[model samples]
Target: MYKILAVDDEIEILKVIDEFLTQAGFMVKIAQDAEAGLEILAKEKPDLLILDMRMPGIGGEGLLRELSRKKIDIPAIILTGYARTDAGLGFVKKDSLKILVKPVNLSILLETVNECLRGKRDGQTKDPDC
Candidate 1:
């Protein structure tokens, strides 16, 4: 099973992601915030990262910047409730990773997980089956 680390400040969202991804046959770990996520990233090195775009202190954008600076190329799906503004777009535009607007659909999340784990990067498109 592919290992996934899901990071979100919202406990409810994290719980939902853990439950759904775990049931989908992906091993799941959750971090309540980006700092916690960094710790998990260092140790677990999950195959995919499901991140919330906003959080307290060093939000998802900040975390992505840090990863970029360190040259860590982990595939990430950034979910945000906020409107798709330039602020949210700036960081994600770099790697061709798509941002899923929240609240997200479970099937799409699974599809995205599958895509990222399969090494799909630049030039990714939506799976119609999802």
Candidate 2:
């Protein structure tokens, strides 16, 4: 099973993602904040990361930037309530497979996750359907 790490400040959202992804046969890990997420990322090394763009401190973009600085490459999906053209999104765009606006559609999230994993297995940056 593909392992997935999701970081979000919203506990309810994390619970929903965990339940859905787990039901879909993925090993899911959730962190309530970026600091916790970083720890999990280092220890678990999940196949994909589903991150919320806004949080208390060291938000999703910050986390992604830190990963880049540390040379850690992982497929990512950014979930946000903000618009696609939000200025904060510019930094992490290159590393993200998709920028999904919240509240996210679970089915679409599942499809995107599958495509990301499939692309990784095929040694591609992204799937054609992504």
Candidate 3:
């Protein structure tokens, strides 16, 4: 099973994702914030990351930039309740970054995760072209 790390400040959001992804046959890890998420990234090297753009400590954009700087190329999907403009859409404009607006559809999220994993397996060097 693929390993996925979900980082969100909201406990309910993290719990929901952990439960849903677990039911989908993934090994899901939950991080309360970006700092914990980065720690998990270093130790777990998860196949995918699900992030929330807004959080108390280091936000999702900062985390993404840090990961890129560290050359950690794991695929990430950003979920946020904030408007795209307010959240600074530029950080996630990269092809590899998938942004899901809040109240995300679980089915869509699952499908996106599967697609990303498949792309990784097929040796697709670039991020999702969509």
Clashes of each: 0, 0, 0
Error of 2 at 26 (Å): 0.2
lDDT of 3 by residue, 1-130 (tens): 7899999999998899999999989999999999999999999989989999888877887898789788788778889886572346454436667778889999999988887788766787544652
Candidate 2: residue pairs that collide: none
Give per-residue CA lDDT, model 2, range 1-130, as digits (tens).
8899999999999999999999999999999999899999999999999999789899887888888789787888889998772465455546455778998999999988987788767988655544
- Highest lDDT among the candidates is held by which one? 2
lDDT of 2: 0.85
TM-score of 1: 0.84
Provide the TM-score for each candidate, comma-separated. 0.84, 0.88, 0.88
When sorted by lDDT, best at the front, the candidate numbers are 2, 3, 1
Task: After the best TM-score superposition of candidate 3, give how far the Cα of residue 6 lies from its true spot, in angstroms.
Answer: 0.2
Summarize candidate 1's per-residue lDDT along 1-130 as a digit string, tens digits.
6788999999999999999999999899999889889899989978778899789989888888888778777777888897673365454434436578899999999987887766433433432221
Q: Could you tell me the TM-score of candidate 3?
A: 0.88
- The per-prediction CA RMSD against the true structure, in angstroms, equals 4.2, 2.1, 2.1
Which 10 successive residues of model 1 have the least lDDT summed?
Answer: 121-130
